[model samples]
Target: MLNKSEISFSFVFSIIVMAELICGSVESLSTYHYFTKPSILISLIFFFWKHAQHLDAKTKWLTLLALLFSLLGDVFLMFVNASANYFISGLLAFLLAHIMYVLVFLRKKKNSKKVLPFTALLLIYAATLFYFLKAGLGDLLIPVIVYMGIILLMAITAFLRQGNVTKNSFILVFLGALFFITSDSLLALNKFYEPLPFSNISIMLTYSIAQLFIVFGLLKQS
Candidate 1:
């Protein structure tokens, strides 16, 4: 049973998640596509700030840095519509943020055995990426390869370093990263190649879920 403050904070976080989804939908429908990422990033900051007292000093700082990098990723992606460079910049920022998360979680835990599954999973994903690229996926190869590598590394790092953190929370973040990867992969597939059915809806769905899970995981950790 949650106290009044806990319940209140949860409600506020839910609203932020809802707002992110709504903004994403509107962006997909309207001409102002740039608003979605920034809007969600702002909501994430607010969500973290609202629950700041519950988090440790290190977690709080890392969360702030992650949000900052996320904002940068959004800004770069929003403006660089011509080439993959902008996307790469955004990817790098996000990669760094993910590394921060891995570090934070590792500091919380030190068991190497817990991460074995994650390492195996990463290897499989890497193999798939290599196969896809070798099969001549065209311009889609670079972005997919980079994104997959970064995300898999993050997951494996977190898995290998699980310490004091709750299993549920770690699972939540791991799943969130998975959804984020799915959303971005779908977007890239649609943009560079053929437009798949439900591409827009899929992106919004996975993106919203990814944010929700990540925020919830952070809150739970705190």
Candidate 2:
């Protein structure tokens, strides 16, 4: 059950996410936007930290670390124009974040009897996406492929946790992984393939919701 403070924080969090979406959609991807971008994840970090006190030490650390890396990714991506290295840095940060998420989710039972079908489905989707994106990936092929692998692993682990965690919690985290992958897919499409209409809005919308669901799902584990 949620307390008053948690409820209030959630309301405020929703407002902040909405503001970020609106601002991200309207503003050009300039230095100013970069400076403002970190605010979203920073707020989420606080949200996670505040609620994480109830979690076990290992879970708490993993959750916080994931959020920290995500925050770093947001900051680094902001400076992608200043230096291409920043894009690499951002990629690495998010990669680490996904790794942390996979580790956290995998703490549950590894061999679930019910998850095989979902696992096969996700694997097929990942393979199809890689096939489509491979031609355009060129020099960045290896890193992107590795990133995709980790995220698919993360999503699979989330689904496999069904019996290990609350039903609501599992659903939330699984959807979070789904949206995270969707956001990243849109990002790759825009950068390596043709630009999608309203890519910024779509990517950030899904990305922000992904983080929120993941954070809250983990919080529910406590």
Candidate 3:
């Protein structure tokens, strides 16, 4: 069970997530994501740094940087209307963030046969998404493929934590990875293909919860 401090901390961030989702969901209020979106990752970074002091330096820094890059991605994406370049920048930032997660999840991990099945599933998912996205991807074809591959690898690494970490940790991180995938899939589908109905709400809702799940999973290690 969470102590008082952790409980309060969660409550505060939960408000931020709700506010951001509300702001993002409405067309008129979307610009407010500039404030609320970054707030999400900033709270996460602080929470992570606080609880992760017990972690080895490498793991701690990697996790911290991942959150940092995600913040950068959020900021850059908000400017995407100004230029496609901002979208690319945001994509790169998230790619780096996913790479950091892949590295962090690889720490002291165990080999498992589950890797193949999980990887195959992700590949099929990626390939099918790409099939729809390929026509619209245009100049971004390579970058999108690479980013999708990294996130898939990140999820696989999260699953590989099984048999090595506590069952709770494995479950939390694995679920987090899956949620992250869902959030990004909705995002890509909405942006690159047909616009999803209420995509903003669905995207931010899953994304906010996904980050919390991953952070809570890491904290469980303590």
Q: Judging by TM-score against the true structure, name the best candidate.
A: 3
- lDDT against the true structure, per candidate, is 0.67, 0.84, 0.88
The order of the candidates by lDDT, greatest first, is 3, 2, 1
Better structure of 1 and 2 per lDDT: 2
Q: Could you give the C-alpha RMSD of every candidate to the true structure, in order shown?
A: 3.6, 2.0, 1.5
List where candidate 2 sits over 4 angstroms from the true fold.
1-6, 27-32
Per residue, candidate 1 scores C-alpha lDDT tens digits across 1-222 of: 244755576576566555555654674644544555576667677767877778888888887887778778767866566876887787788777776766665655656765777678668766764654445456656766766677676666555434556776777776887787777667656665567786756876686677667666766764
In model 1, the clashing pairs are: 108-164, 109-163
Cα lDDT tens digits, model 3, 54-131, are 788998999899999999998998888899999999999999999999999999478998799888988999989999
Error of 3 at 98 (Å): 0.6
Candidate 3 TM-score over all chains jointly = 0.95
Query: Worst lDDT window (10 residues) for model 1?
Result: 27-36
Q: Is candidate 1 or candidate 3 better by lDDT?
A: 3
* Collision count for each candidate, in order: 2, 0, 0
TM-scores for all candidates: the values are: 0.75, 0.92, 0.95
